[model samples]
Structure formats: C-alpha cells, structure tokens
Target chain A: ELKVEQNPLFLSMQEGKNYTIYCNYSTTSDRLYWYRQDPGKSLESLFVLLSNGAVKQEGRLMASLDTKARLSTLHITAAVHDLSATYFCAVSPALYSGGGADGLTFGKGTHLIIQP
Target chain B: DAGVTQSPTHLIKTRGQQVTLRCSPISGHKSVSWYQQVLGQGPQFIFQYYEKEERGRGNFPDRFSARQFPNYSSELNVNALLLGDSALYLCAAGRPQETQYFGPGTRLLVL
Candidate 1:
C-alpha cells in the first residue's frame, strides 16, 4: 500500500511570512498533485508534478517533486490571509501494460493559518 | 467549462436507509471518479468509471456501488448505510494520466 505523510499538520504564520509543507510517500509513483480545500468546500487542484525535479508555481505557492526520494514539497511565500486553508498532496501509482487504476492516495493535509 | 457538478448538495438519512448521489462531468471529460472525505481526514477513493464502464474500485465494501452513463454522468449508490457512512461525497472528472477536477461535494449525514 502507498502511504503519504505530510509534516506540520497545523501551521500558523503571520502575513508576509514564508513556510514550506512537506509530503513524503512510501512507494514510487507516476505523478504527484497538490490540492487546496477551504472550510466546507471541496478540493481544488493546485499543481501536478509529473517527473523528478518537476516544479510548478502559482501566485505565492510553489510545488516541487523528487521522485527518487519519493518526496514532494509545497512552499508558500509571502503568505496572505486568503491562503489560510488546508492543503493536500496526492500520488498516482505507475500504470501497467493493461491499464491499471488511476486513483490517488492523499496525505492527511496541512491546515495553514495566516494571521493578519 | 463548468468543472464538475453534483446533485443534492446535502442529505439527511437514517441508518439502514439507502441513498443515491449524482454527478455530471465537465464538458469533454470522459472519466468520472468518486471519493469520500470524513471530517479532519483526507479524501478516500471509491470508484472510477470511464466510457460508461467501471474501471476501478477502492477498498469500499459492496454496499457502495457506482455506474456511469453514456453522457459521462455518474451515480453513486449506498445500500444499508451506517452512521459511520456519514461524510462528504465528492465527484471528480478528468482523463487518464491527467488532473481530476472535483465537484463541490454532497454532504451526507447518517443519523
């Protein structure tokens, strides 16, 4: 089974500060994804890292993947109050010749609070 | 496009009652997936359907089942539900090897 672990489950930071959330998986995967969930809302896709050393950035958030280490990271720069939400990292297992399942295994998520 | 859409934004049911949830995929999206998210936990995959066929299932019991229609819409049915089955049910749409966009989700409360 593939297990995903994320650090700093609860984060509190001041506006304009920077922080990084880490996600580590137990096995190899074909791709990594980051998602954001606001209170009482469904998840919103953030980034999809497809290869080792893959990096993507949107606004003040940036995500990177390291396949060899089975690790991925979501970094936040100049945090704002609007960024206060839960973030999740998910992984998709490699596919087989006959076409395997494409379900995603997700981490527990990091709850971030940016104090103004 | 309109991302993904789910019907019955919220539902209240008693134990042993059955419930059915609906989903409509995004325009041009061929795949639909279902997930369950409990309070304070990550979402768990339930099923995946492509081309109106069941492609994969998660570790959920037989009580949970789903099917897709020709128009890429889907329905998730739960039989003999328990209090523990109460959770937010989410639907996603996408293609294989691509990112899945999720719907707002249906909040099901089993009393």
Candidate 2:
C-alpha cells in the first residue's frame, strides 16, 4: 500500500513570512498534485508535478517534486491572509501506463493559518 | 465549461437506510470518480468509471456501489449505511491522462 505523510499538520504564520510544507510518499509514483481546500468548499488544483525535478509556481506558492526520494514540497512566499487554507499533496502510482485507473493517495493535509 | 456537478447538496439518513448520490461530468469528460472526505481528513477514492464501465474501485465494503451512464453521468449508492458513512461525498470528472476536476461535494449525515 502507498502511504503519504505530511509535516507540520498545523502551521501559523504572519503575513509576509515564508514557509514550506513537506510531503513524503512510501511508494513509487510518477505524478504528484497539490490542492487547496477551504472549509465547506471543493478542492482547487495548485500544481501537478509530473517528473522528477519538476517545479511549478502560482502566485506566491510553488511546488516541486523529487521522484527518487519519493518526496514533494510546497513553498509559500510572502504569505497572505487569503492564503489560509488546508493544502494537500496527492500521488498517483501509475509508473507504466501513465494513465491508469488507480486513484491518488493523499496526505493528511497541512492547515495553514496566515495572520495579517 | 462548467465543472463537475452533483445533486442534493446535503442529505440525512438513518442507519440501515440507502442513499443515492448523482454526478454529471464535464461536457467532454468521459471519466467520473467518486471520493469520500471526513471532517479533518483528506478525500478517499471510492470508485472510478470510464465509458460507463467500472475501471477501478477502492477498499470499500460491498455495501458501496456505483455506475456510470452513457452521457458520462454517474451515481453512487450506499446500502446499510453506518454512522461512519457520514461524510462529504465528492465527484470528479476528467479524460484519460488529464487532471480530474472535482465538484463541490454532497454532505451526507447518517444518524
């Protein structure tokens, strides 16, 4: 079974500060995804890292993947109050087909609180 | 294009009762997936359907079942519900090898 672990389950940061959330998976996977979810709302895709060393950035948030280490990271730069939400990292273990029917295994999520 | 849509935003049922949830995929999307999210936890995969056929299923009990229609719409049915079954049920749509887009989810409360 694939297992995903995330660090700093709860984070509190002041506006303008920077922080990083770490996600580590136990099995081999080809794709890693980042998503943000607010209370009572659906998940919003942040980034999709498809390869090792692949990195994607949107606004003040950036995500990177390292397949060899089975790890991924989400970095926040100059955090804002609006960025307060739960962020999740998911991994899909479709090494061969690249598009299998297997669903993603998700981390517990990092609850970020950006104080203004 | 509109994102994935689900019907009956919220539902309440008792133990041993059955509930059916509906989902409509995006216009050109042929794959539909279902997930369950409990409070303070990430979503867990339930089923995946492509071309109106079951392609994948998660580690759920036999009481949980799903089916897809020709139009790419889908329904999730749960029988003999337990209190643990109360959660937010989410539906997602996408094409093969593409990112899945999720719906707002239906909140089900089992008493």
Candidate 3:
C-alpha cells in the first residue's frame, strides 16, 4: 500500500519565523503537490514538484521534492498570520494520467498557526 | 473559468438513509473524482470517472457509487449509509491524469 506521512501535525510559530513541514511516502513517485486549505474551504494548489530536486516557490512558501528519499517538504519563510492554514502534500505515483488505482496519496496535513 | 463546484454545501442524513451528492467539474475538464474526508484525516479517494466511464475505484464498499455525465458533471450515491459515512465529500476535476482542482466540499452529518 502507498502511504503518506507528514511531520509536525500542528505548529504554532511567531510572525517572521520559519518552519518546514515534511512529507514522506512509502514508495517511489514522480510527482508531488503542495496545497493549502483554509478553515472550511477547498484546497488551493500551491506547488507541483515534478522531479527529483524540483523546487517551486511562491511568495513566502517554497516546496521541494526528493524522489530518491521519497520525501517532500513545504517550507514557510517569514510566516504571517494570514499564511496560517492546513498544508498538505500529495504524491502522484506517476507522471502519466493512467496510473489508475495508485492515484495521489495525501499527507495528513500540517495545521499551522502563526501568531503575531 | 469556474473551479470545481459541488451542491448543497451542507447535508444531514439519518442512518440507513440514502443520499446523492452532485459535482460539476471545471469547464473543458474531462475527469472527475470523489473523496471522503473525516474531520482529522486526509481525503480518501472514492471514485474517478473519465470520458463518462468509471476509470478508478478506491477501497470503498459497493454501497458507494458514482457516474459522470456528458457534460462532465457527476453524482455520488451512497446506499444504506452508516454513521461512519458522515464526512465531508469533496469533488475534484482534472484532465486524464493531472492536478485536480477541488470544490468547496459538502459537509454531511449522519445521525
């Protein structure tokens, strides 16, 4: 079975602090995605890391993937209250759309709270 | 374009009752997928429909089923529901195999 595990299920940090959320998977994968979910809202896609050493950044958020280690990380830099949300990492087993039952497996998510 | 859309932002059902939830994918997107999320866990895949046919199914029981329409809209039907089925049902849309765009899920409460 393909499983995804996330570290630091909950994090509370002061403004301007930095933290990293980790996602480890049980098997090899070719794609990884980062998403942000606000309270009672749908997930908003943040980054789609496609290859080993792939890195994507938007504003204060950056995500990286390491296929060899089967891990992905979402890093928050200079965090702010407005950036508070549950961050999730999803791993898609293959780049082709026909991976079938082995679709994206998502981490349990990191509930982040930034205090002023 | 409008992102994925789901109907009845909230619902309440009694145990053993049947319920049908709806979803409309993004424009021109040909694939639709369903997921159930409990309060504290990541979303679990339920079904994936592409080209109006069932493409993938998760480890869910037969009591759960779904279908896609010509317009790429979809419906999830749950029969003989148990209290365990109380969860947030999320609909996502994408191409054959692409990053899915999620909808504001329907929060279902089972009594």
Candidate 4:
C-alpha cells in the first residue's frame, strides 16, 4: 500500500508570511504532483515533479521532489489571501510496463487560510 | 483546448439506488481516470482507463464499475449505493506519464 502523508494539515497564517508544506511517501516512486483546491471546487494542478531532484516553481509556489528519500515539498513565498486553499500531494506508483496509467494515491490535503 | 468535463454537476440518490456519472476527456487525451472525494479530504482514486481498457483500479468494492468508450469518454456506475458512497466524483484526463487535468466533480448526495 502506498501512503502519502502531508504535514500542517490545518494552517492559519497572515499574509506575506512564508511557509512550507512537506509530503512524505512510503514507497518508491518517481512521479509526484502538487495541487490546490478551493472550497467546493475542482483541483488545480500546481506542479508535477517527474524525477529525483526535480524542482518547479510558479509565481508564489515552488515544489521539489526527492525520490530516494521518497519526499516532496511545496513552499509558499510571501503568501497572499488568494493562495489560501487546500494543498495536496499525490504519488503514482511505478509500473513494470505502462507508466502513470495507474491512478494516483493522494495525501490528506493541507488546508491553508491566509488572513489579510 | 477544452479541459475534462463531467455531467449533471449535482446528483441526489437514496440508499440501495443506482447512479451513473459521465465524463468526457480533453481533446486528444486517450486516458481517463475517476476519483472520489469526500468533504475535507483529498480525492481517492477509483479507476483508470487507457485505450478503452482498464489499466488500473483502486481498493474500491465491486459495486463500483467504469468503462471507457471509443471516443475516450467514460462512465462510472455505482450499484447498491450506501450512505458512504456519497461524495464528489472527479474525472481526470491526460496522456500517459503526464499530469492529469481534473474536471469540476459531480457532487453526489445520498439520503
């Protein structure tokens, strides 16, 4: 069973503060994804880290993956109220033949609230 | 390109009833996946279909079944629904080895 665990499940922070959400997985996999979901809305893809030490960043969010350690992290820089949303990290298990056709196992998301 | 799309954005059913949800994948995307999301939790994978064949399935029960069509559209059917079956059913579409784009989920409420 592949397990993805995320820390700081609930966060209430002020605007302009920086924070990092960590994601740890139990199994060995090369693909990790980060997503954000607003209340009662569909998930918005943030980053897809496909290899070890792969790092990708958007305007205010950065995500990195370390496959050997089976860990990934999403960092928020000077957050704003618009960034307040549930963040999730998902892992896809490696298959022998087909890759990523398998469904993803997701972590219990981190619910963030950024107050102005 | 248009993203993944789901039908009947909201549904209501009772226990022991049957329900079917629909999904249309993004243009040129041959793979479709389904997930169930309860309130206050992340989405859980249910099934993944590629080229109209079941490539993977999650740890769901036999009551949950899905099939993909020639056009890459898909349907998820639930039989003998229970109260626990009420959730937001999400459909994602993408190619192999890529980040799948999620659709606005169909919210199911069981009474």
Candidate 5:
C-alpha cells in the first residue's frame, strides 16, 4: 500500500519560532505537493516538488523533497498566529496511463497552532 | 483567470437518496477530477475525466459515478447514498492530470 506519513500531527509554536514538518512516503514517486487548509476553507496550494533536492519557498514557509529517501519537509519560519492551519502532503506516481491514475495520495495532515 | 468553481456550497440529503454535484473547470483546463474529503482527513481521489472521457477511478463503489462534458465541466453522482457518504466533495482542474488546482469544496450532510 502506498502511504504518506507526516510527523508532529499537532504543532504548537510561539510567534517568530521556526519548525519543520516532515513527510515520509512508502514506495517511489516523482512528485510531491503541500497544501494548507484554513478553518472552513478549501486547500491552498503551497509547494510542488518535482525532483530530488527540490526546494521551494513562499512567504514564511519552505518545502524540500528528497526522493531517494522518500521524504519531504515543510519548514515554517517566523511563525505567526495567522499562520495557524492544517497542512498536508500528497504524492503521486511519475506517470499516468489509461485507467492508471497518478492520483495524489495524501498524508493525514498536521495541525499547527501558533501562539501570540 | 477564474479558478475551478463548484455549485451548491452546501447540501443536506436523507439516507438512500441520490445527489449530484457540479463543477466547472478553469478556463482552458482540459482535465477535471473529483475527490471526497471526510472531516479531518485529506481528499481522496474519486474520478478523473479528460476530454469528456473517463481516465481514472478510485477505490469507491459503483454507486459513485461521474462524467465530463465537452465544455470541461463535470458532475459527480452518488446513488443510494449512505450516512457515511457525508463529506466535502472537491473538484479540481488541470491541463493534463498531474498538477491539479482545486476549487472550494461542496459540503454534504446526510441526514
């Protein structure tokens, strides 16, 4: 079974703190994606990692992918109260053929609560 | 450009009834996919349609079906819905099928 696991299912941090959320997957895949979900809101795309050692950042969040190890990380720098939300990591196969969907398999998600 | 859009932001249905949810993909997008998201969980792929043809399906049962129109819009139909069917139905669109852009989901509450 293809599975994605995220560390620290719950994270509580103070403003200006830095932390990293880890995502480990079973099996090999070429693509990984991260998303954020606010209360009652749809998923907001965060990062798309395409290759090993791929790194992307936006705002206070940064993400990295290590395909060799089947791991990905989402690092939050200088956290703020408004940055609190649940984050998820999804993985998909490298290619899709007819009836073979590279549909993203997602992690259970990590809830981050920031304290002011 | 407007992102993907879904109708009936919320719905309430009785058990054993049927429900259909609609979605319009982003302009110029050719692929539409559907997902079921239970509370506190990630969205699970349900179906994928490209060019008005079914491309992929998930582990869901036959009671769930979907189709894409020529215009790239799609509909997800659930028959004989059960109480466990209550979930947030999400629609996403993409050029091919790998990287998807999701729309605000429709929340379904089964009574």
Candidate 6:
C-alpha cells in the first residue's frame, strides 16, 4: 500500500512569516497534488506536480516534487491570514494510464493557523 | 462551465438506515470520483467511475456501492449505515490525465 506522511500536523505562524510543509510518500509515483481545504468547504487544487524536480508556484505558495526520493514539499512564503487552512498532499500510485480513474492516497493534512 | 456538484448539502440518518448521495460532473467530463472525509482527517477515496463504468474502488465494505449514468451523473448508496459512516462525502470530476476538481460535498451524519 502507498502511504503519505506530512509533517507539522498543526502549525501556528504569524503573518509575514515563512514556513514549509513536507510530504513524504512510501512508494514511487509521478503524480503528486496539493490541495487546500477550509473548515467545511471543498478542496481547492493548489498544485499538481507530475515529474521529478517539477515545481509549481501560485502566489505565496510553491510546491515541488522529487519522485526519485518519493517526497514532495509545499513551501509558503510571507504567510497571510487568508492563507490559513488545512493543506493536504496526495499521491497516485503506479498503473496510471492517464484515465483519471486512479484514486489518490492523501496525508493527514497540515492544519495551518496564520495569526495576523 | 460549472464544477462538480453534489445534492443534499447535509443529511441526517439513524443507524441501519440507507442513504443515497448524488453527484453531477462538470459538463463534458466523463470521470467521476467519490471520497469520504471525516472530521479532523483527510479525505479517503471511495470509488471512481469513467464512461459510466466502474473504474476503481477503495477498501470499502460491500454495503457501499455506486454507479454512473449515461449523462455522467453518479450516485453513491450506503446501506446499513453506521456512526462511523458520518463524514463529508465529496465528488470530483475530471478528464483523462487532468486535475480533478472537488465539489462542495454532502455532509452525512449517521446517528
């Protein structure tokens, strides 16, 4: 089974600070995704890292993938209050035929609280 | 185009009862996936359908079943619901090799 582990389950940082959320997977996968979820809302796609050394950035958030090491990282810069939300990293295992039928294994999510 | 949509934003049912959740994928989307998210936990995959056919299933019990329609809409039926079944049921829609977008989710509470 593929397992995904994320560090800093609960983070409390002040606005303008910088932090990084690390996601480590137990299996090799080329597809890694980052999502943000509010208290009761649906997940918002943040980044989709498809290949090794692939990195994507949106606003103050940046995500990178290292498929060879089975690891991915989501880095936050100049954190803001509106950026506070639970962030998750998900991985899709092998046998990916681009059918979009494969399910994703997700980490426990990092609950972020950005204090203004 | 509108994103994935789910019906009955919230539902409350007693144990042993059955409940059905509905999802309408984005226009022209042929793949739909279901997930369950418990409070304070990440979402878990439940099922995936493509072209109105079952493409994948998670480690759920037989009581959990789902099917897709010709219009690409999908329904998730859970039988003999348990308190553990109380969670946020989410639907995702996407195309081949595309990023799946999630719906608002149906919050099901089993008493």
Worst 10 residues of 6 chain B by lDDT: B92-101
TM-scores, all models, native as reference: 0.98, 0.97, 0.96, 0.97, 0.96, 0.97
CA lDDT of every candidate:
0.94, 0.91, 0.87, 0.93, 0.90, 0.92
DockQ of 2: 0.72
What is the TM-score of model 1 when looking only at chain B? 0.98
For residue B72, give model 1's deviation from the true position in Å. Answer: 0.9
Clashing pairs in 6: none
Ranking of models by DockQ:
1, 4, 6, 2, 5, 3
Model 6 Cα lDDT, one tens digit per residue, A1-116: 78999998999999999999999999777789999999889999999888999999999999999988888999999999999999999988765544345688889999999999
Per-residue lDDT over A1-116 for candidate 1, one digit per residue giving the tens place of the 0 to 100 score: 88999998999999999999999999878789999999999999999999999999999999999999998999999999999999999988777533366788889999999999
Model 4 residue A89 CA deviation (Å) reads 0.3
Per-residue lDDT for A11-116 in model 4, tens only? Answer: 9999999999999999878789999999989999999999999999999999999898999999999999999999999989886534456599999999999999
Question: What are the per-model C-alpha RMSD values against the true structure?
Answer: 1.1, 1.3, 1.6, 1.2, 1.5, 1.5
Taking the tens digit of each residue's C-alpha lDDT, what string does model 3 give over A1-116? Answer: 67999999999999999999999998767878888898888888898887899998999998999999999988889998999999988876664545664346788999999999
Q: Model 1 off-target regions past 4 Å?
A: A97-99
Candidate 1 scores a C-alpha RMSD against the true structure in Å of: 1.1
Model 3 chain B weakest lDDT span, ten residues long:
B92-101
In candidate 1 the C-alpha lDDT for residue A66 amounts to 94
Candidate 2 vs. true structure, TM-score: 0.97
Off by over 4 Å in 4: A97-100
Model 4 lDDT per residue over B1-111, tens place: 788999989999999999999999999999999999999888999999999999899889999999999999999999999999999999999988789899999999999
lDDT of 2 by residue, B3-81 (tens): 8999989999999999999999999999999999999999998999999989888889999999999899999999999
| Per-residue C-alpha lDDT of model 5 across residues B1-111, encoded as one tens digit per residue | 899999989999999999999999999998898999999888898898888988888889999999999899999999998999999999988876356889999999999
Cand. 3 Cα-lDDT = 0.87
Give the higher-DockQ candidate: 5 or 6: 6
